[model samples]
Target: MTGIRSGSLVAAVLSLGLLAGCGGGSGNQPESFENFTAEEIYKRGEYELENTRKPKDAVKYFTEVERLYPYSEWAKRALIMQAYSHHRARDYEEARGAAQRFIDTYPGDEDAAYAKYLLALSYYDQIDEIGRDQGLTFQALQSLREVIEQYPDTEYARSAILKFDLAFDHLAAKEMEIGRYYLKRGHYTAAINRFRVVVEEFQTTTHTPEALMRLVEAYLALGLNDQAQTAGAILGHNFRSSPFYQDAYAQLRGHGLQPEARGDSWLTRVYRQVIQGKWL
Candidate 1:
């Protein structure tokens, strides 16, 4: 959510106006935007975006441009600006609607990639903390994947890839939070289920090591020594350097058990996958 540079946007609008051989408007120009030309209205939007620093006001001008001059180049540009202005104003639903309209109306436009990225940001930016609903995180991942898959050569795709990883990691973090909650409440089976999801579905995330360690703790608490040892064995094999692995090792040793794949349980399957380099 970087702020748009006022100077750069103003310069770009000025260049567009000069190229079109049109003036923005004199001081005597009508207060109503209906009397302004497309370029004039667009320039006014840029002015509000930059000088006035009121993105909601900028959205009004941009939306008017699209309404007054539909199918025109200025209208297309204004639509993208509408998306940006709504985003800048922190109106995520409006930003998503504007971005989606741009994508549907001008799919092949050069700014389409930016529209897609903006759509993704509308979801990704809402994933502010792990405690929030995970639905937004899922939506962000889906939209980000669209950007990466659809515009792989663009800079937006590179940025999407980074954000995608963060959002994915955020999912794992949420699982860890819930698993920790269950474990603290002596709900070992419930904690194990949550930790298992991290180990199996989110292994690439940074939370995997901690999940494996938690699996060891939960299984041991349930008198499932074989599963606990298998979990510790997996943790040691893949994340030996992690403090979580050290903790898992100490927990196993305290129970007079060694970290090894000792049963045909889920952790054993995970351990086998780790041995074959199929699991992280």
Candidate 2:
């Protein structure tokens, strides 16, 4: 569904008529379609997809091919193309169903990789802005993980890996957003909980530096000077070049203190674990 759905595949679909030469002309005729061979009907689907740009009609023909000859090789190819056609038409649920069916029926087929990718994309493409429910993002992450782990050498895996990282970062960003909301309302402990999730569980995310800096803000707001100072110290040590670290340093300095690990708070535990090889 991303980036034009492969124009090369569309081109090949359009060329199927020439390759077979049996029903190229009468394939689109509804009256002739029922009498057409499996390949001919499948080709008609591709013809609608590439030439007429009618995916709904393409899906009709593709589905018919699958229904008429469920065990034929053309049925296998038609089923996957049905998924592609549904995806191109933005019928994501239908696309997912067709894609999942293809994967279940032909797990070892070469096109199964493509079917799995389509299934993952069915979820990945639904992710909206951060304010929406993150259930879709979580599903996207899981499906993308499948593509990465099961087909790591494929191009689909590479794309899935990239999307997986972005989805992971999106989760961290959501935590940061809620953390900032709590911090703005002076709910320091609630804000700290959200920021800590990013620091501890989402350390690789870009939001971690900001989360640590926010911990400094929240702890300082709660008058937990040692915790605030320790948070600032961790920010400066791990993300010295980050603007968040600089802001944390300024926040600590404003309190007549400086960045140093001088607390027994959770952040101090993190610092000990990271800097002193101590487990908490």
Candidate 3:
């Protein structure tokens, strides 16, 4: 009875193995993906972009579709999708290259404007803070300006204007940063030029107050007492509540020059008088 039971078990195992082999050898199995037409492929790529959670994987399929149908409409759609996927992946260099290629190849295409916008955005996204290297910031500003100049009627131009404003402040801040360095090193003249640039070009920026304050210090260091007082009066008038105004007032008092209590500072009065030859 024991020998008969063991032989029956071995037969059952062999039958199961044969069935598994037959299942593995099935030749009529369906393909993983359907062989889609060009329009179908383009539609599928759009679907993948909008519906799929895994953008990187979607990019792989889109790129494959592009390579397979270079002359078809599907290929153009796939290229644009591939560039967006690279951007979503934070692969900025790849995105930039893809966008540039699209702009070069399809200048008259409707998507060309979007491609140019993306290329500029890729550069803008890499801007460093004001205290660091501003090479990327400068490039971003240039690219964004190009978009604004070339596509003034597009939505991208409006967005570029906002970005340009931000970049302008950052550039102004960088100049102020260098000015502060010059101030710390006692290179007051060099610092004055940088601060002047901020006042002239970035008048609406937050750095304007600091630049004005630094200008006062620069004039004082140069022994131009009348100019120092004029700068201080402007600082006080424009930024009445600023701590810099109090500091400037103290500096003038320390030099035995009384700050004007009413309209303008005494130095401003003197400067006008000197310019009008009233003091002579």
Candidate 4:
């Protein structure tokens, strides 16, 4: 998962120190924190994060600011930083909780966009590779979509858009990965199902050309010449110069068929949309 930026985190950490509110309680552990003002505790969290590079320790102080001065604006600011600290420490669940609470309690706050973005990042960052469960990628897409739609004018929205695209592509890559695995295992039907997902739903992704090519291979293996030709036709229609298209063309020729969409297959619909501009 992506951690909070040290520069932004430090700036946010220091900014809250400008606010006013003191902490006091004899029973509180760490006598310094007990006596420090809310801003001071928040500052300590910043120091821990920036100077000490100890985000786990930083989270402690930021959490304390909210607990001790829950009503202060510093508390609100600290809550977001607390989320950042948890994220930097790789405590994704805690980061998500703190960020979600910030959004819930301060929906109209300027930092709400950042909080929501952080919540999305919590999931996005977890989607490391194609092997990971796609559930996190789906969650990231939903959260990022909310950010893009809800706060379009914000900087966070712009970043969310980029991340959303990357996550979407990642999902397609996962499908390609599984399809390739099944294809190598000689499971043509299973492989075709996986490749079809990329070709249909993830058509805009970079994986689409390769997915179409894989469909050609899988269908040919299953003795489905019409489906194979249709897949090759779609690949050639949109990605003619691509290596995948070249490969599909070569494979179709081996079967004494040419690349042309001539069946009521899923690829034929894509050919209509992409080639004939007939999308509904």
**lDDT tens readout by residue for model 2, 1-280:** 6546788677656556543343345554444445667876887788889988988878978887888788899999999999999999989999999999999999899998899999889888888799989998988999999998888899999999898999999999999999999999999989999999999889888998899899989988989999899988888878899999999999989999999999477888888876874422
The C-alpha lDDT values of all candidates are 0.90, 0.86, 0.73, 0.86
**Per-residue C-alpha lDDT of model 3 across residues 113-229, encoded as one tens digit per residue:** 788888888888887666778887888889899889988999999999999888889999999999999999999889988987886677778777688778778877887776676
Order of the predicted models by lDDT, top scorer first: 1, 4, 2, 3
lDDT, candidate 1, at 132: 85
Order the candidates by TM-score, highest first: 1, 4, 2, 3
Assess candidate 4 and give its lDDT: 0.86
Question: For candidate 4, what is the TM-score?
Answer: 0.87
Which parts of model 1 have CA positions greater than 4 angstroms off? Answer: 1-31
1-280 per-residue lDDT for model 1 (tens digits) = 2346877677677655552333334543334555567887788779778987999978877887888789999999999999999999999999999999999999999999999999999999999889988999999999999999999999999999999999999999999999999999999999999999998899999999999999999999999999999999988888899999999999999999999999799888888888998875
**Number of the top candidate by TM-score?**
1
lDDT of 1 at 183: 100
lDDT-wise, the better of 1 and 3 is 1
Clash list (residue pairs), candidate 2: none
Model 2 RMSD in Å is: 7.0
- lDDT tens per residue, model 4, 78-111: 9999899999988999999999999999999999
Please identify which of the two predictions, 2 or 4, would achieve the higher TM-score against the true structure: 4
**Deviating ranges (above 4 Å) for candidate 2:** 1-32, 276-280
